[model samples]
Structures are given as structure tokens and as C-alpha cells.
Target: MFGILVSAFNVVLGFVMRSVIAKFFAYFVMWFITTEFVSVLQSAGILPTASALAGAFGSIGSDVWYFMDLCSFSFGAPLVISAYATRFIIRRIPVIG
Candidate 1:
């Protein structure tokens, strides 16, 4: 009964997770595409706005900060996700008798 319960739980968890991931990625990709489109539009514009002017004000420190933030998130997010997924996969697989 315990084995059955554990197996059932893994199956249910995997199925629900897959469904949620599918939906989440669908919306996520759509959002990324739209944001990229908007960025392209902004770049194509001839005149700059307040945001553009303000963005130009910073010196080396802000540039370093920007790079650091980008690097931290770019590397951190995927590494954390992969590690967490590895743990999840390990947990989900049952040991052979």
C-alpha cells in the first residue's frame, strides 16, 4: 500500500507538473516575443524619450551594476532550475527491488 501510494503520488505530480509547465512556457514565450517586438520598435524610433535620456546619465558604476545583475540572473536562474529539477527527478524515481 505504501508503494502504491508513493507511485501514485509521483505519477500525479509528474502529470500535473508537465501540464503546468506546458501552459507556463506557452505564455512565457508569448510574453518574451511581445517584449522583444516592443524593444525593436523602441530602437527603430528616431527620437529618444525620457527613459532613453535617463538611461544615458550613468557612468561606469551603473554599467558594472547592470552587467552584474544581468550575469547573476542569467547564470543563477538556469543553474538553480537545473539543480532543483535534478533533485526532483531523483526523488521521483523509485529504487529497484
Candidate 2:
């Protein structure tokens, strides 16, 4: 499920890049950076541990897929909100445009 979301995001990013080479480059760099950042966070225990995340659903007798969806919403919702806010803020910046 998370894999699918990441793949879909890549496709959208590809369209934004507008060139085959640029698309590939962007995907690779984004993947590398995201992978590393997640790794570091996991290692630092900033992000939930896999076993802990699984246990969270198990305690409530829910499946991992549902938990993944919940996690997606938990993270994605704020990001979408922030993106909108950032866009508005950037447009209002007199020097940016």
C-alpha cells in the first residue's frame, strides 16, 4: 500500500519534471533522500518501530493495511495542509514572484 502511494507520487512527479531524463533523475534522488531520512528517523526512534506500529493495530484487532491507511492519513493530511499554506504564503511574498 505504501509502495503504491510512493509509485503514484513518482508518476505525478514525472509529469511535473516534463522530461524522461529529468524524471528518472528526480525519482532516483527523491527515493535516495527519502530512504535515508526514514532510515535515520527509524534509527533515532523518532518514527514508530515496525513492531510497535504492527502492535498498535494488533491491540485493536485490526489489520496492517488499515494501519497503513491510518498512517497515510495521519502524515499526508498535515502535508497537504502545509502545502496549501505554503503556496499561499509564497504567493504573498513580494520578492518571490
- Candidate 2 per-residue lDDT over residues 33-87, each given as its tens digit: 6556556656898655658756765665447558768789668855885687556
The superposed Cα distance between candidate 1 and the true structure at residue 48, in angstroms, equals 11
With a 3 Å backbone cut-off (N, CA, C), the pairs that clash in candidate 1 are none
Show the colliding residue pairs in model 2: none
| Reference-based lDDT, residue 9, model 2 | 100
| Candidate 2 wrongly placed segments (more than 4 Å) | 1-18, 51-97
Q: Which model scores highest in lDDT?
A: 2
lDDT tens digits, residue span 2-97, model 1: 999999999999988899888888778766665565466468884356676457645438667687687885578558856874465445434311
Model 1 scores worst on lDDT over the 10 consecutive residues at 88-97
Clashes of each: 0, 0
